[model samples]
Target: METKKCTSRQSHFAKKRYILYDVNPLEGFNLRRDVYVRIATFLKRLNAEDKQYQWILVLPPWGPLYHWQSNHIGSQIQLKWGMFFDIESLRKYIPVMEMHEFISDYPVNNGKTTIDIIYQLRNDKNMYETGIFKEKNMIVSCSNGPVSYKIIHDQQYTGFFWGYSNISSYDLQCLIFHGTILNLKNNFNPNLYRSIMFDHMEIPLHYTYGSTEYWEARRSMRYNSILYNIAYNFTSKYINLMEHMDLICDLKNNQGKNLSQKPPQTPVTHGFDLTVNGIAFIVNFLDHFTETYLVIIDAHTKWPKVLNLKKIMEAYGLLEKFKCLLARYDSPIHVVTDGGPQLSSASSLSIEASSSCV
Candidate 1:
C-alpha cells in the first residue's frame, strides 16, 4: 500500500514538455510541411512510451518563404499556423499548439520567453564526401560556416525564430546529426528542460516511412477551410471562364493582348438539315448474335441512322451503307468510325468515294 501511494504521487507530478522545431531558412514551404510529419511521428513515439512527463508538440509558425512570392497577399512574415492548417485536425493525431499558444502558456522573463535549449543540426560532411552514410549524433561547437543563430552579449543565442523577437535560448548546442528522427530521442532530458527547439530540423528523415504512424500524421495535416474555399472559388471561376474562352491569360497583365485573342470558331457551315458537316460511326453487336448494325451519327445535330446488315458485315456492305447515307443527305465532309473490323477492312477507295474518313 505504501509503494502504491508513492507511484500515484509520482504520476500526479508528471510535467508537460513542449517540443518546438524549425526547418532551415532556405527550405521552402512544402518541405517544411514534410518536416511537421517527422516531428509529429517523434512526439507520438515519445508519448507511447508512457514516460513520467507528457510531451506536447509546439507548431512552428509559417513565415517569409521564398515560394510564397505573391505580392498581392501582402507580407507573409510571421503568419500563424492556424492560418493555413486546421488545428483541431492536427490535434487528433498528436497534442499540438500554435506558437502564440505556447507563448501564452510559457513563463516569460522581461517580456521574452527563453527556450530551455536549442539544437542546431548539421549534416555530417564526411558522409557526403565518402559516399557512406551512418547514424551520427554528437554535440560539437558551431561550425565556422554561416550559422543562423548568433550568441548575443547577454549570453543568450538569438536567430530568426519565425521573426519573433521575444524568443531566445540560453543553452544552444550544435549537433552533427545524420539519421532518422527517432535518433533524436536521446537529446530529450525531461528533468532538465521543459521546452526544446531544434533548428534545421528537416535534416533528419522520417522514423518509419509509410508506416501507420506516418500515414496518421500525414492525414492529420488538414488545410484550413479558408484555403479550401479559396481553391474552390478559383476552380469554379476558371471553369466558368473556360466555357467562353479557350486561351489562358496572364494574370499579372490582365489587359494584355493575349486576353483579347478570340476563341476558335466552330467548323460547322450548314444548317441541321442542309448538309452532314461531321459524322461519327459505330457498330453494335451486343444485342443480337445473328445480325450486325452500323450506326452513324451527325456530329452537329446528333441525328443517328442505323443500317441493318446480313449475317456478316463486310467492307463492301459498309461502303454501300455510307453511300446510301450520302445519297439521302449531302456527302459528309468528315467521317469517323469506331475502328470496327468492317471499317478497318474497308478499302481506302471505297471510303474516300463517299467522304473523307477523319
Candidate 2:
C-alpha cells in the first residue's frame, strides 16, 4: 500500500488532531477505536463541507492501533498500544455536557444567581457610587434568587476569620450613621430601604442554629461594625454628615422594651390623660424619631390651649422632649394650671428654647 502525499487543502482545515491510547484492548474495542472512528467520520463530513473541526481520539489501556487517513491505501492497519482496566478512570475523558441536559437549559441571566459577580465587584476594592436605583434595578432584572453559598462563602470566611470579628459595636453603630449619610447623598434617602435590608439579614440569623449557628453568630457579631464603617466612609465621602445619633438612640430603646421605661415620664399639661390612640401615635413617632412635639388644640374651645414636649427639642417640642428624656435622666416637670395667666410670655420662650439648651 502506498502512502498518499498530504494536500494543502486538507492541511488547512485539519489543523490539529488529539489521540489517546488505551491500556486494555477490550475497553479499547468499546471506546477508543469505535468512538475515534465516529469522531473522525464526523470531521471528514465537516471537512468535505468546507468546515474546520478538531478531532480527539481516545485509546484504550492496551490496543491494536487502527489508523484512518484519506490517503492511506489499505484498511488492515493494526499496532499494539497499552492497557486500561478502571472504568472510573475513563470518566476523566467523558464529555461533561452529556451528564445533564438541564444545565444547558439554564436561563441566560442565571449568572446573577451565583455570588461570582457580586464578589468580583466587592473584591475590586474600588469604592462604588451605587445608588438605590441601580441596586434595586439590578435586583428586579435578575432572574435568580439571592446569592448562592458558593459565591459568598469566601467573603464570609474572610470577614469572619480575619480580625474583622474584633471590630467594635460603636464602630458598627457608626456604619449605621454613615448608611444614613449615603442615603441622603444618593438623593433618595429612604430609611425604609436600610431598615428592610437589615431586617432581612437579621431574621435568618435569629433562627439559625448548629453549624449555621456559628455563621449567624459571627455575622451578628460583626454586622453592625462592618456595615457602619462601610456606610460611614461611603456617606462621608459622597453625602452630607448625618445626624445618626437620634436613629441609633431609637433603635437601642425599642429593641426589647418601652421608650418610657428608658426615659422619664413627664406630666401632661391641663391635667388631661391621653387616649389610647394618642399613646399609640406617640409610640409610633418614637419608633421613627427620638423626639416629638404636640400642640393640644382644644377641639371644643377651638383654640391651641396646651403644649407638650417629648424629650428632644424641635418645632414639635413634644417629640423632642421624649427623645431628651430617653437620652438623659431628667426629672419630669408637671405643669399646674393657673387661671391667672401671669407668665404667658415666659412659658412660650421656655417651650421655644428647649432644643437650644440641649
Candidate 3:
C-alpha cells in the first residue's frame, strides 16, 4: 500500500515537470530579448550585404599587419558566412549583453566599454531579419532590404498576439498563421478566419501558407539554392505546403450579388488550329545556363513538331523560329500560346507573313 502511494506521488510530480517544460524550461534564466536585438544591430553596422548575417572576424594565427592590408576587407569573410546556418552560431559570435568583467582587475572606467554597442534596437527595429527574397547579383541584399520596411506592421501584430521576449515578429506571424490553419482544420469558421487573415492581417493575396500559389512559390524558391539560402522559414514554411487554399480566402465578389446574369454561349468551329507552346527555362542545367523548347502541334491532325533551341526562346528568338516554321510548313490557320513572351510577340510576325508570303 505504501509503495503504491509513493509511486502515485512520483508520477504526479513527473507530469507537473513535463507541463512546466512545455510552458518553458529555461524561463528562470531571465534571458532578455534586448541581448539578441543588440547583437543583430551591431552586425548591421558593418555596411555590407544583408547585415543580419556577417562573417565573424577572427584573428589570423600566422598573419602580420601588412599581409592583412594586402587583401580586400570582405575577402576574409568570403565563402565563410555560408548558405545555411542557425541563430546559435550567431549568439556565440557576439552577445548583445556583455557579462565579462572589465580586465585590469580594477574598476578604472577609462577605456571603451561594451555598453557602446548596446543600442537597445530602438524605434521598433526587428532584432532579426527574414523572409524577403532577392535574385541575380543583389539577391541577398534584396531579401534583407524588406526587413526594416516590414517591422512596423509585422512587429505590431507579433507583439499584440504573442509578446514573448525571445520571439521575433517573423516567427510570431508564422505561428499565428499556423495556428489559424489548425483551428480551421478543427472546423473553425472559414469566413471569420479569412476575414481576419486577409483584411486584418493584410497578408498579400495568394500568399497564404496553404494556398496553391504559396506552394508553387516555395517550390520555385527551394529549387534555386541561391534564393533558398536567404529564406528564414524552413519548418513552418512547409507546415501546410501540400494543402489547398482554404476556402475562406476565396472571397466571392458581391458586386453582382442581387443581379441575374445569362450564361455565355460559345460557337464551335471545325477549322485547322495551331497549338504553339514554349517551355520556358524551367531550371538552369548549370549555373548561368538555361534553354527553352518550342512545340507546335496540329489540334486536329495530331501531328507535333518539336524544336530544341540553344538559346532561351526570348521574344526575338520566338519570332525567328515561328517564321522559319511558317516558311516551311502550312500557315497555321490560328495560333495559341501560353503567354510566352516569345510566342506572344509572334503575333506581329504572323501578320507580316500573312501580308508578304501567305
Candidate 4:
C-alpha cells in the first residue's frame, strides 16, 4: 500500500484500460450487514490482480452528514445510496491513479474535455515537447460509456424537494470530481480539471446510446434547454394496453372474465403457438464502438431477449438464436415469420425444430 511502490508497479506492458466501475449504489437496502461486507470484499479484489488491462473503481467520498442538528443524524439508509466507492478505503488509490491524472491535457482556453491521452500527447508534440508523460494511452470510462447518469444530473435549480435528496446522479459527478481531488499532489492544473468536472452538472440530457451525432461536441446548446421535454413526451405514452383482469373483476364482482371472458371456443390455436421475432438495432460494445443487436420478442408474453450479431440478420446467427429459444421455452408447433431471408423456413433452424414457417 506504499504510494511509491504502487506507482512504480503501475507500468504497462500492453495496452492498459482503466475500467472505472460504478459501485452498486444499493447494497444495504434490506438493512443487511452481510451485503455491505460482501461489497467491500468484492471491491478489494480489483487491486488484488496485476494484468495488462485492469478495472479501477472510483467511489464517492462517502461520510456522515447530519441535517437540522448534529445530534439528529441521518440513518444508514442515506449512506448506501451514493454509487461512489466507499470513502474510507479510497485514499489508498490517491497515488495509484488519480482522477486529475486522467484530466484532458488539452490547452485551457479550448473548453472542457474528457481525457484524450493520445491527442493531447500529440498536441504536446506539436509544441516541440518530448518524453512528456510517456506511458501507454489511457482511456477513461473503459468499462462503461462516457454518458453517465451523473453527467446529466441537474443540481443548480431548486424545487420543493430542491436537492434535499441528492438522489439524482450527484454521486457520479462526485465520483469523477474526487478522481481529480485525490490526485491533487500531482495535478498539472487543478483548476482546469475542476472546470471539466463542472460540465457534468451543467447539462441534463442523457447521451444517445447508438448515435454518435453529438459525441463530437459533448453537448449542443440547443438540446440542453428542451430535449428532456421531447423525452418526457415519449416516456409518457408507453402504457399497458392489456386488459387489467383485477380491475375488471373488481368491477364485475368476479362474475366472469379472468382473461378475455370471451374465449376462442372453436380451437386451441395461437395461444399454444408462441412465435419469436427480432429487430436489429445498434449497440456499443466493450472493444468495438457499435454492433447490430437482434432483439427477439415473444409475441404472446411480450418478453424479449437480445442477441448481438456481426452482420444484419445473418442466417447462421439467426439459427443459433432460434435454437437457443427452442431449448429455453416451449417448442412452437409452427414458427411464423414474414419470410425474411434470415428467418426463412428454408433455414436449418426450422428443420431442427420441426417448425413450419408461415
Candidate 5:
C-alpha cells in the first residue's frame, strides 16, 4: 500500500489542506446529506486537534440522481452546490468550497488536476454475513474490488470524479473500513499530500450520531432561497385563494353570523425588511471612496433606513451591522430579505430569511 508522495510547491510553508470526498453513485440525496454531517464533524475535530493545519471540505456536485425522474429539465449532471443548498450557511458550521473553486485553486498540469490518492471504501463482507462487526480500517488489495475506477494513462487512475473528466488520481487503493468518520483521520499524511479524495464516503458512520455538533451541522444545511420562494409563491397563489373561496362560500350559507367584528392584527414591532444595493461602486484613491448601502425597512410602517458601508461585508460583519440595525427598533422576531449570500448568512443567526418571510 505504498503511494508515491506528491508534494505541492507551497507544502514547505503551507498550513492549509483540502479534503475532497464522494458517496457511492447509487446513494440517494438524503443519504448523501447525512455523510456531509459526518464529514463536517470530522473536519471540525481535525481543525481542533491538529493546530498545525487547517482543513477545508470540498463539496461534491449533485446531478443525474436515480431518483430524479423529471425528463424536461435536461441533464442535471455537474450541478453546483449553491443551486440547492445555502453555501454561506454551510460555511457557518465548517469551511466549504465548491468543486469549481477547488479546481481553480488547486494546481493543475496539462488541463488536469491529479488527486494525490483515492481511497476506495468497501464493506466488510465477512462481518455482514456472520452478523458480527468490529471496528477496522484495513488497506486491502484492489485486484478483486469494485471496478469503478481504471488506470487511463501515465499511471493516472480515472473514474466518475462526479462526471468531471479532467480530474484524476496518481494512485488508487481499496480500504475495508468499518468505523466512525473520525477514524479516517489516520489515513492522512499532511506533509506529503495536500489533497486527497474518498470515493465511497457513505460507508463511515457519524462520530456522535445525535450530539449537539451533529444537530448544528444539520441545521446549517438550509435549502436555497429559490426553493423557499417557490414554495411560498405556491402557497400564496393557490392555497390562499382556496381558503378565500371557502370563506366566501361560508358567508353565502351562514350570512352575517360568520362575519367578524374585529380586523386582522398588524405586526407593529419585530418586523423588518432588509436589502442591499443592487450594484457596487469602486473608487480610486481619491475622495470618492467605494461604497455600498444596506437598507432596512419596517414591515408595518413601510419606513426605510439606509446604512452606508465602504464595501460589501461577509457573514460576520454583516451580522454585526444587522444587530445594530435591529437595536433601533427592537429585537427582531421575523425579518425578510432577498436571500442574497450576505443577508441570508446574517439572518441565519436567529431566523431564516426569504422574500416573503423570515
Candidate 6:
C-alpha cells in the first residue's frame, strides 16, 4: 500500500528506449512475486551481457509497485532492467475494457496498438469537459516513447463496423500503434494485442433513446423477411436485443388495445386570456366572462423562450371558467380573448393556446 517513486538517469551507452506492458491486476491469473523476481534476475543477466533491451512489467493496482522498485537498485545496471509497472494499483483505476475491445477488433497495424479509451475519458470531467471526447476518441501512446505511425486499412474497416465515430476511430487507432512503438522505445514491454483485447468480449453495445428509432425501423423491415430471421438468429443470444424485442411486442399489443378505447381528448375552443399575473386580474369584473372559454393567455408570453413561465394560470382559468359557465348557463361557451400585445409578440400563438388548454 506504500507509495514509491524511482528515478533513473539516461544511460550514456543506452538509447532512451523502453517496452511497456499493460498488466491488469483484475485479470485472469495474478503473477506471483517469485515469478517477477526470476524475471528480474534474467533481465539483470541480459543487461550484464550487454543486450540493449529493457523490460517493464506493468502490474495491476493490486500488485506491488514498491516491490519491483526496491528490487532493481543502483546506477551501474544499464542496458537491460526489469521493473513492475502498476498504474491501476497506484490509481485504483479500472481501465475501459469495452473500448479496448473495439480497438482490438480494429484492423490496423502500425507496429503499435492503440486502444481508444474514449469511454473512460467520458467519465473524466477534465478530459472531456467541452464534449469533444464524446464526439472524438482519445489516442494514448501505449508505447514507452514517442513514435510516428499509421493504421492498417483493415483496422479502419473494423472500427467502422463497430460503429465508432469516424474521427474517434481513426485517431484512436493511430494513437494506439504510435503509443506501442513509443513504449517499446522507452524500454517497456507492452503487449499490444493482449492489452487492447483485455475486456473485448464483455464490451456492451452502445444503447440510447435515439438508437431506439433505428432499432424499431430495422425490426419492422425484418419482421417478415429472411433478413429478419437472420437477425433474430444473431441477436437472440444477446440479452439486450431479446429484451428490446419483448418491448416491441408489448407495444404492439398495447396499440391494439388502445384502438378500442374512448376517443382522444380534443379541445373545442381556440384562444382566450388568463391573467393571474396579467391584465385579466384587473379586468376580472367583465360580465362577459364565461366559464366555458377554453383559451387563456398570459402576459409573460413575450418573454424569452427560456424564461416563459408555465401555462398553469391559463389552465386554471379555463377549468374554472368551464365549471362556472356549465353551472350557470348549463352549456358550453367557446371562450375568446383578444390576441394581446404580449401573446401576439411571440410566434405560434395557436399552437401555444391549444397546448395550454389540453
The number of residue pairs in model 6 that clash at the backbone is 40
Candidate 1 C-alpha lDDT tens digits along 1-358? 3343233223334488889998877789779888998888888888989567789999888878877779797888878888988687688778999899999987666688878789889989989899999999999877645578888887778888888999988678889999999888899777667788998898998876777667667756756656654643554445442232211111111111121111133222211111111122222332266767665543222345566666446767666765654444333233223222212221332333344332
How much lDDT does candidate 5 score?
0.65
Give the alpha carbon lDDT tens digit for every residue of 79-137 in model 2: 21211222221222221111112122211121211101111001111224443222211
lDDT of each: 0.65, 0.24, 0.24, 0.27, 0.65, 0.25
**Model 5 Cα lDDT, one tens digit per residue, 198-244:** 87899998887888678667766766656645644554455632221
Clashing pairs in 5: none
> Which of 1 and 6 is ahead in lDDT?
1
lDDT of 4 by residue, 1-358 (tens): 1342223234334233332222233322222222223222332343354232333332222223232234455442223222322222232322123333332321222233222111111112322355443222232442333332333322221111111232221122221222211121232222222211222211112223223322211111111112333432343355332221110000110112221111223121211211111111111212235666655543222334466666646676666655655544333332322222222222333325424221
As a TM-score, model 1 comes out at: 0.62
**Lowest-sum lDDT 10-residue window in model 2:** 167-176
Deviation of model 5 at 206, angstroms: 1.1
Residue ranges of candidate 6 with Cα displaced over 4 Å: 1-17, 22-30, 51-358
Evaluated at residue 124, the lDDT of candidate 3 is 14
RMSD of each: 18.1, 31.4, 25.8, 19.6, 17.1, 25.4
Model 3: lDDT of residue 38: 26
- The runs of at least 3 residues in candidate 4 whose Cα sits more than 4 Å from the true structure, single-residue gaps closed, are 1-18, 21-51, 56-324, 328-358
For TM-score, the strongest prediction is 5
Evaluate model 6: give its lDDT.
Answer: 0.25
lDDT of 1: 0.65
TM-score of each: 0.62, 0.15, 0.17, 0.20, 0.67, 0.16
Query: How much lDDT does candidate 2 score?
Result: 0.24
Error of 3 at 217 (Å): 47
| Model 6 per-residue lDDT at 42 | 31
* Distance from true location, Cα of 294 in model 2, Å: 8.5
How many Å off is the CA of 180 in candidate 5? 0.6
Candidates 3 and 4 compared by lDDT, better number: 4
